[model samples]
Target chain A: MALATLKNVRFAGMATCVPRRILSNINDCPPSLRSERERLVRNIGIETRRICQEWQCLSDLAYDAANRLIDQLGWKKEDIDGLIVVTQSPDYLIPSTAIILQDRLGLEHTTIAYDVNLGCSGYPFGLHLLGSLIATGSVRKGLLVVGDKSATIKDPLFSDAGTVTALEFRENSNPWFFDLNSDGSGFKAIMLPVGGHRNPVKFFHLIPSEDEHGILHLPTDLILDGTAVLSFSTQRVPPAVEKTLAYANKKIDEIDYFLFHQANKMINETIRKKLRLPEERVPSTLKEFGNTSGASIPVTITARLREKLTEGSKQLLLGGFGIGLSWGTAIIKVEEACLPELIEA
Target chain B: MEEFIEKFQEAVDFQDPVEVTENTVLLDLPEWDSLAALGVIVMFDIEYGKTITGDHLLKSKTIKDLFELTVA
Candidate 1:
């Protein structure tokens, strides 16, 4: 249980960008799977998703989001003392996306910048880091950019998104609470088996294997064990959220919204029921965003709760789980001005 | 667990739901595939209040074995 609470740092504002190109799963379904398409769509909660264009990458979306947020908040680029981009998909293996973003966003040269490679649980995890940095007073304000284009292939399992969240020092003593956990033993539960240093892509990695449904995927392709992920979600997330709420001294009814990672419909519904939250309080973007990896939570926030969050101050309980077999829960107060318009690129 | 066979028959998609039995081997059914396996997990979670992993579904040789795991 990796848990911590920090003070004097609140989520200042947030903006998200999803590509304009949409892919409808109905059209993507093949002849054999046509009959099961409706049921699959209902279970997954993804009928259509935004897939990026060939010229676009996660960085492009993240940059667009960051640029919009900075402009919305009317902050000088020099005032952004830190920048961190969290994602598994990077433009290159060498230069960190944060460094490139710093140059692209025109932030001061003295700003702290880097990247954290994570998926699914990356949003609250990014918040955890930003809270720690702001508490240390080494940086007055920072930008945490999270985005991913993990499903730029033949799979309808994921959609692309980028989110930028502003974290700044505030005079208010409001606390930001986070609970982070990881089970690396189950790292293979959701992963790309090849293309890393441990398992470089070889010729055989490109070889395709047919599943029972006759879907063919290369060995290098990202794999998702639905049952395994579901089991983990059912067993882990509720407890983590409950424990974090206790740590933050919050009651369930006191929360205005419980924004969970938009992994899909089934897993999220199960968790929501277990937590006894009504449907209206739990917003989902799976139908449009389709598991945007680390960007899921923020993307869902920007897509579904943009109006509610921008209208007034609200207490939010955010939970994210998957990949790394990791889970994170955060309870915080998001003020009315802390939300920006959802940007579409 | 008496309704297990009926549930399995529905998800298995056999021509006749009556043909499914506790003793029926899962892979022997034409409809028993990855999708069916996931459906089984969902059924156990929602109906039986059991969390079944993919490995557990694969290890269960027959409908009876899966039903018993739901109890276990």
Candidate 2:
């Protein structure tokens, strides 16, 4: 039960940046999946996804999003005390992406900058990380840049984007409640077996091979066991959500919106039904952006509830699960968050 | 057992109306594919409150075998 409430911290604003290229699962299906295109689109709920150009990387998108958010919030880069980047995709194998982003964002050299290796569960976890730091009051403000530009595998299941969530210290603010958990035994449920030190990239890993489903994959590519992942998410997420609500001493109905990590249509829908939340209360970006991995939660908020989040005060319950076999829930208050228009790079 | 069979039919959602019995070799059906497997997995989890893995789905040959795994 990793549950805690961080005080003296509030969300200032957030911005999301996605690649300009849009690839439709229905219109641009590979020959192997062409026959099941309609069925896949219906069940998975990913109509299209944004893909980065060959020259672009995840850091590029994160940098753009951070700049947009900083500019929108009208904050000086030097005032920021910390920068935490959450991404499984890095600009390079060495020296955390946050360091690069720190220099790129023109933040002070004294700022605390680092990266967390996570996917799907990254956003809520990143919030907890930076929120706790800011709660200390020594760290006045910080940027949580989380997202991923998945491998160019030509699968609609993966989309590319980055987001920057700006959080600042404000005494007597509403406490942010969070419950985070991870199961290492199920890490294999979604993994890249190669390219890591455990299994160094080999010649064979570079060559593409067809799986039983006829979808081709390189050994270095992400291998997702849909059945295992679906079962894990459905069973794990609902409990975490309930626990977070209970931890906050808040009821499910009190939350104005439920933002779930946009894994897919089926997984999210199943979790929603288990919690008995109405479809209207749970917003989804899956239909348009597919699964942007860590970026899904913020991207969905920026894409779907931009106006409401920007103009009104609301209670939000966010659930992020999958990858690292991890899951977490957060209950927070958003009051006129300074959200800018979605950026394309 | 009959209830399980009916729900399984609904979950798999074959294009053609196909009669599924306890003895039916589920994987042998033309409509039984990865998507169908996912459907059954979700059904078992949501309806039976049992979490069955991809390995369990592959190891079970007949519909009865799957039902047993769900209840076992």
Best by lDDT: 2
The CAPRI-style docking tier of model 2 reads medium
Which candidate ranks first by TM-score, i.e. highest? 2
| Clashing residue pairs in candidate 2 (N, C-alpha, C atoms within 3 angstroms) | none
Runs off by more than 4 Å, candidate 1 = A207-216, B5-19
Question: What is candidate 2's lDDT per residue for B15-61, written digit by digit as tens?
Answer: 56688889999767887887788888888877887888789988999
lDDT of 1 by residue, A1-345 (tens): 477888898688899888988888778777777666755776678888888898888999988888888988899888999999998888888789899989999999999999998888889999988878888897899999988987654566689899999999886757889999989999988988898899998988888989767888788878887778888988899899999999988888888899998888778887888777899999888887788888988887887788877888889998989899889999888886566666778
Residue pairs whose backbone atoms clash in candidate 1: none
| Accuracy of chain B in candidate 2 (TM-score) | 0.94
Which residue window of length 10 is worst by lDDT in model 2 chain A?
A: A29-38
- Cα error, residue B53 of model 1, in Å, equals 2.5
TM-score of each: 0.92, 0.94
Q: Please write out the lDDT profile of model 2 over residues A113-188, one tens digit for every residue.
A: 9999999999999999999999987579899999998836467798999999999999998989999998999988
